[model samples]
Target: MSGNWTEQRIPDQRGRIAIVTGGNTGLGFETARMLAGHGATVVLAVRDVEKGRQAAARITGNTAVQLLDLTSLDSIRTAAADLRAAYPRIDLLINNAGVMYTPKLTTADGFELQFGTNHLGHFALTGLLLESLLPVPGSRVVTVSSTAHRINAAIHFDDLLWQRSYSRSGAYGQSKLANLMFTYELQRRLAYHGSTIAVAAHPGVSNTELARNLPGWMRMIVTGLAPLITQKAAIGALPTLRAATDPSILGGEFYGPDGWGEMRGYPKLVTSSAASHDQKIQQQLWAVSEELTGVTFPVK
Candidate 1:
């Protein structure tokens, strides 16, 4: 066995608690299910409460769905506050909610749809829930990003909201790249604070709801070729689960598929693109995120 996910087994997560945003369907739901099955109390945070209930009902084990609309900062804050008051500790936070290609849409806060939901929302959620995370000694945050990041010129500070120009593909790429930058920067911050949390993970070319914002033809084409061209959502969740639960994982290192070209397979330590490691860009993004979201991480 390769000692990656193939040889790996789900550890004892009996006492763990997790929040998985957009977890009512697709990769998020699968990841939530896997974690719950391994004995973690999983919270499936979704935009639709009724639909979330329906989705959680399909899973064989225990799961709870809570209303969480990432585009709204108010919703994110409220959810985090409520969860913090309820759960004793949050063992894992899977910032998995995101939007992919859309014609041109803006969030409630007037940010680009892809960039807003994918990067900014998760960024804010992590910041808001920082208190809950620190209480859990072995807590970890596993953020999901895509290979689309390779082409991304991250954080066009001049046109942060894509007001001057916008392309669905470009916006999606930039958002995914932001995820990587946030992940790395978060690990650095955790180390600086002497905290016991680790953060990492990537899912390359998985069949998921991320493309719900794409054109009809694009969605259909991708759906048609999903089984052949991409890995299933179950397999895609492995890397994220490993990062969240595995004891051997170290902070700042990313995990992705081990198959050819990273399209599909079990989880393994994978390298991120050079641009994902740009410290200056990470710092700039972190600062900008705090300003835009109005929620600075209260870390010393």
Candidate 2:
């Protein structure tokens, strides 16, 4: 497909149902808005119920809010149960929620905050909801990764939780890298089932609250270069929107901006790091994630 893909190209979604995590703000919000506007029933699965409701209110059409605290397995289970009861089938599951460059912190489950939330949380959520997606012929699972996945990133099997020492950037990289690996491995698994598909997309550097956790100096540099380096949240959401809606999109394909260095512009299929394509590492991470999250997919 061309790099000029836009939300205008999204086909009618009259009977589709989309669930976007972190849909309360930023790229997730824009994605949810466009999907709902295109006639899909969208659920803003967010950490904060009130904020999600407010976000839903801002969008027209069939939109609802559901509580989903990715940091907590209990919350994921509850939210998935509710969704299963409400909708037997789901057309799109967008793993758009994530934390970046957070301080050394652990989730309720004691895993590193960034890895736990960005990768493992989505991993568990998708597995728990696999049944709902499998029966839907054209269902998709789109996970939002990042360019940072290539920045000296690895799974860090020895210290997956950053227990020995921590660098915010490194942990964030691991999490994002895991996102890509998960999508690739998931696509492979889904191929056997021959129902749903898995794809990944990255929002080119966007001006969003996700950057609030950056170091002081980095934040200052970003602010100074914002005009040239960052795009609006709506623009940043294009890659994900395309990954979710574009009929030509294939399983395991990744999308990102078309600008220089992929910092900004229209969405197009993009390549991830060599490390991200390592099938052995992807399988290992899949096993680790399942063990860590205690949620296994129905697929082999």
Candidate 3:
């Protein structure tokens, strides 16, 4: 347990099986590479099989790929079934794929694009795959959230799907906030099980393609600030790597950069927004999620 955590500290991962969504590029690619390099059997659960294969080929250890488009429930179910049949046990499930600040749109299931892909997608996938992890000691579910969760974020129970109106940033914020709430609530449910745990991490302001949706003017601003504010993707993936492998991590803890405003630095145990810690909202969101996706957890 040090003040600064980096990829070098990732414990030996031999014999482990890790599934990282969006593993083909950016932060996800970096995460998959490190895990595979450490001897873990890494599955690049990406939407593009060709890209996944290309990414896997670049890595040095055992690796595989499964097509999963988080925007579609059918895709999630199929991918989950395929993964379950392929691996009897899952040591780690990294819900790292997400869309950010896209124009007002909905997923194949008709949920808001960001909410559907970021929160509900991971939610359903985790529920379907929980059985494989529950029996495996030290198993972890690490969801990648974002610092944007604190900006203009609210659960919007009455308008969870963003049917009324849409602000791309607000929607993205809600999704990221849901990511944290889901982690905390999931950890609570798994506490009695004693084998599986849920944790969350954010990459801070990393230079990644996840920001491609930024508006033209905003992109310019970001590009101008990049030198001073953003870190590389490899560095951005550290918090997630730590959250996934740090043996000292407990259920419900969040990790992020240790620098000012958590923008860029080595990984460290970090706190999320106070709103993300709301128990009632978390439970409510969970119920709504299950009702919407029809995917219930194996745990109580």
What lDDT does the true structure give each of the candidates?
Answer: 0.84, 0.95, 0.94
Q: For candidate 1, what is the lDDT?
A: 0.84
lDDT, candidate 2, residue 91?
94
Candidate 1 on 200-234: residue-level lDDT in tens?
Answer: 67777787766677788888898898877688788
What is the TM-score of each predicted model, taking all chains together? 0.94, 0.99, 0.99
Model 3 accuracy (lDDT, Cα): 0.94
* Candidate 1 residue spans exceeding 4 A from truth: 1-8, 216-225
Predicted structure 2: lDDT: 0.95
Cα displacement (angstroms), candidate 2, residue 153, comes to 2.3
lDDT of 1 at 143: 88
Candidate 2 lDDT, 1-300, residue by residue in tens: 444788888889999999999999999999999999999999999999999999999999999889999999999999999999898999999999999999999999999999999999999999999899998988999999999998776889999999999999999999999999999999999999966899999999999999999999999999999999999999999999999988889999999999999999999989999999999999999999999889999998
